[model samples]
Target: MPATFLHRFVLSIGFLSLFHSAYSAAQHRSYLRLNELDFTHLPLDIIIQALISLFVIMYGVMNVAGDFKEIKASAELENKSWETFRNIPSFYTFSHRGKFLAFPHQTGNKKHN
Candidate 1:
């Protein structure tokens, strides 16, 4: 089953507390006995490094998603600009009698009769 945010958070806290308690309890035991048991050992430096790496990776992923969204929006705007340009008549096209006309190319194809 997929774990939700709350589930993951609870699990993380629970595991950390459990390990803390176990390590604290082990300190009162004999040094030789503590060394014999491996479960109570907790290397905090590696855990901190892993957490930082995970945060950085997640941040990078979010940045990439935002970049793709911006690119999509720009492409849509460019398409609309092209459509508008195609629908507007150019003043450079004049009639046979030298009168300037401003009619879209699509509408100019229809006969008056």
Candidate 2:
């Protein structure tokens, strides 16, 4: 579906706000608030860089959490701790104490083979 002209204009405004808002504040590395990590330093570039790095780290963590462990453990447990995301099993499996989803096809027994 195509968006209306109003929607496009709104999106443009939102993107423009980033540069405008950053430019308005002569003080660099300044944020409305600071967290434990942002202590002491108040430079705009530093703060922005830190925020970007944090976002990348968080994104990587979320991506890693999505899959890997489930498929590996499918051979040993009845229910894999790593879940199937959109039908794609995990790429790796972790070692747990008898807690996992076992694959019936590989293991004749309902429990870990």
Candidate 3:
């Protein structure tokens, strides 16, 4: 049921069929048609092409996966910052003075004095 297992099985079957047709000969077939080749008898060119294609496809997928991971982590950090800010009422004020924070009394309410 796994994708990898299915892929392997399909490749095996394809290779077997390719070679089977190449070397096996039918009873009524001529010399050219009777010839049957084995699955492992594939030409080097085909193997090289397969390898090149696999490399390119795998590389592209891995690159995309890495980028997705980075974006997901950044989103998580942003959400956490937002959550803390929501729970802390005094977290929003920012000033260039000696104190970067302000207390409730700093609101200039005379009742607190």
Quick one: best lDDT, which candidate?
1
lDDT of 2 at 48: 70
Per-residue lDDT for 45 in model 2?
A: 61
List per-candidate RMSD values in Å. Answer: 17.6, 17.8, 16.8
Q: Estimate each model's TM-score.
A: 0.27, 0.24, 0.29
Residue-level error in angstroms, candidate 1, position 100: 60
Off by over 4 Å in 2: 29-113
Task: Write the number of the candidate with greater lDDT, choosing between 1 and 3.
Answer: 1
Measured on C-alpha atoms, candidate 1 has an lDDT of 0.54
lDDT of 3 by residue, 1-113 (tens): 22354455555555555454444433223443456533334455545555555555554444433444455657566657566756876665566564536553444545643
Pick the TM-score winner.
3
lDDT of 2 by residue, 1-113 (tens): 34455545544554454445456443433344443244364567645744554555454444444544446654555555545444554655466655556543554546656
Checking candidate 3 for backbone clashes, the offending pairs are 19-37, 19-38, 22-35, 22-36, 22-37, 23-36, 23-37, 24-36, 25-34
lDDT of 1 by residue, 16-58 (tens): 6556555654553556475675455445654554465466545
Give lDDT per model, in order. 0.54, 0.50, 0.50
Error of 1 at 37 (Å): 3.0
Clashes of 3: 9
Candidates sorted by TM-score, best first: 3, 1, 2
**Residue 56 deviation, candidate 3, in Å?**
1.6
Candidate 2 residue-wise lDDT at 9 = 54
Of the two candidates 1 and 2, the one with more favorable TM-score, higher being better, is: 1
